[model samples]
Target chain A: MDDRSFVAAQDFLLSSKTFWTKQIYEDLKRTYEDAVARSGKTPTTPADVAAILEGDTLYRYFAWLERHLQRLKYAGRYGLVPYHDERRSVLAPPLRDTGAELSPTLEMPSYYRRVDIHQHPGGVMSDELDGYVYERGARSTTPLMGASHADLHHRFTDLVAAQDAERVLYGRILDMGCGFGKSTQPFHEAYPDARIDAIDLSGPCLALAAHQAPSRSSPKVRFRQMNACATDYEPDSFDLVTSTMLVHELPPGEIEKLFAEAARILAPGGRMVHLDFHAIDGPFARFMHYGHGLRNNEPFMQPWAEMDIHASLSDKGFTNIKVIPFQEAEGVDLENHAAWRFPWTVIQAELKTGG
Target chain B: MRISDSLILDRPEQNFFADPALDRAFGVVMALATEVYVQRDRVRALERKLEAAGIIDRADMDREPSEDERQANAEDREAFVEGLMINLLGKQQAKGAS
Candidate 1:
């Protein structure tokens, strides 16, 4: 298809997604509320909401639109897959010069290899240009972000920066699951002096990350193809270990392993932080979040949300653990925010320093 | 690193509606809506280009069509409706045959 055709089709999908995010989602919530009110019983869990509105036409429409709009964004005619696949040769060259140290022997995890994460046809690792496809797809992932999609990453980086007031965290930083370097770039910019090793299992994503990364003037930022759950790095190597939107992609057992890995790699009294979706507040919000996981092809999101990160971190020899809601934008009230938004939360803990 | 067939997967099937056919119908609607949007955008682009090139005045383009032109357009509109209705008509005919 022509460029204009693809652009228009994608724009239509994004517009439809905006409607689903706001109008349809609000209607579904209202219907659920009305149903609960009439039932004269307080609904407390996802099961309760399911019982009330499982068969409601509006809820069906909302869920259907959520799933299909995402599917169409990647698979059908004028989809991201076809658009990039057609021009793979042009897109593949620049990505190679990114200086990514890709590991040939690193076996792909079944959890990641099996599901097409975020409903991107081949996931980020299969195709040569899947990184480009993912980058484009992520731009409109949150319709609320609109034109300032990068603002979320920057906001997250600022939060990480504010954690250590006494010292600038520019010493031996490691970014886990740094997809295509969106999460890593902000760190590179924020901590120019820090030796940042950004790692992911997706080779294509790492290549793109390294390619889009800042110039080699300092040459501190390095993107490598490595698993976050188990990396080859020596113990106590990094001053700070962080990941954004990564933990939710991992299964519960694997997330525990990731925390252990972070604990091992991090220096004593070092910080371990992650920005991921953990459903806060009532069960209707959680019902929507888990349903989003199923529809979006992110199988691990529900499991990851249910995980007890605070206790898990404490068990892994971490102290001062904090699991709190993160406001990704300026005016996103944690207590009362409307529309379908990810429960952006910051999972932070510190390794106890050796006396 | 490698592009293996096994590494990729087809889109996971999700059934929100009870009837699979209804799910397929919604998919068709979205696909058609995307195409419709593309066509609408192209028409707008064409109109702007024509106006910019001084081939047509903005006011004149906005004006109502002549009786003959209106008659021709109405026939085209009917043909468009018929094209969409053909599938339903075929299904009805098959039901009668059965």
Candidate 2:
């Protein structure tokens, strides 16, 4: 119940997670290597990798650690859920005046409401204080990020900044699925001149995002509670449309709709870039990534990765489509680094100009 | 369209161990491990405070360890992990031989 106890408990969880990320993952990789070497056949598909590692005891422990570490992070004794729930009175008030517009009549998507995404007890949208819980829980999701978790978002924003010539003044920017505004914060700071609109299905998250922003940023960056697949914005409105770790949350059909919505709202020649999990290295990695989806309550990750993103973008008249591996941290080798990591990737495309 | 009431839903369960009790036992072990770590951290903090306030004579225990000692600590940690994961790993193949 004490703050120190809670802090210590969370710290222990983070250390355990780091152990899992490094040692357990490497051991499993070795197990996979040993399995294939004995079988004298290379795994060409996720199914092959699955067939090889599914029954192995170490593999089972690895998978169990991957799932339950996250579960314990948010829902265990001294977890973020109850900790924030206890402090709701103190924490919830500051979020109410952040200039976020709530949609009183917007219907909750069935997919969003069903599964507890990221194993956050009652989903991020259910409780008024769930946003606070998510914000705390997110700090330790990738154990490697430890105290530098915000660096990932800043790196993503920089990646987007690198591609644009007019970096100083982005006219209109839209950040879809901006949970607690972590992804949007970097954009707001980078393009202070840009008119930014951050939208998410969770009002609590939007409120927290708005609250986190500087008071003077009002009327410049508006946090709106709206769905990514459908919004009340006009066509050709946004100069730069983006989302971070959003697409993989949606089902394949919804992903298509979100792309269509982004295309429709983006101005001609506007850039649409998204940072998400994709571009996995091999079948072994793919097997782990998909298993992550099953254990982590993110059912859409595997489907999104398998979807023909290029064709989908081209279908929406997007040009200059580029899907590249994103280095979330500096000096992380995409090829050789052998720790458990999200296959961070960049998906980018530009709307075609008029003939 | 509305969110569910329970914290955990009856989704397709992922069972790593053969028996469900084993899965739960691991969870308990991890939870207990976290508690133990927290308690140790609290005690360490209390000791530091006591030393700072001149409540205890800890001059001999304040120094950093030698490089060899650090290496020994690292080996101890490695041994701990290996012991915890004993009997879980499978037999090594040719690639694993090296």
* Each prediction's RMSD to truth: 3.0, 8.6
Q: lDDT tens digits, residues B1-98, model 2? A: 11124555667667899898899889889989998988998988898999999898566566787888889799889999987786588745357535
What is the TM-score (0 to 1) of chain A in model 1? 0.97
Clashing pairs in 1: none
User: Please, what are the lDDT tens digits per residue for candidate 2 over residues A1-355?
Assistant: 6799889999888888899999999999998998899999998999999898888998899899889989878887788887787787899888777678988688999999888899888899988887888888888889997778789999999989987757853679999999999988788888887899989999888888877767336578888899999999999899999999999999999999999999999989998999999899999989999999989999999999899999999999899999999999988999999899999999999999960
lDDT, candidate 1, A1-355, per-residue tens: 7888889989999999999889998888889888888889998888988888879889888989988898888876778888887787788888777678898789999988888888887688998798899999999999977987789899988888886665465499999999898998888777878899999999998888777766333579888899999999998899999999999999888999999999998999899889999857898999889999988889898888888777898889999988889998888888987788999999888998861
Q: Which structure among the candidates has the greatest TM-score?
A: 1
Off by over 4 Å in 2: B1-12, B59-98
Give the Cα RMSD of candidate 1: 3.0
Model 2 C-alpha lDDT versus the unseen true structure: 0.88
After aligning candidate 1 to the native by TM-score, how far in Å is the CA of B86 from where it should be?
6.6
lDDT values for all models: 0.86, 0.88
Deviation (Å) of A323 in candidate 1: 0.7
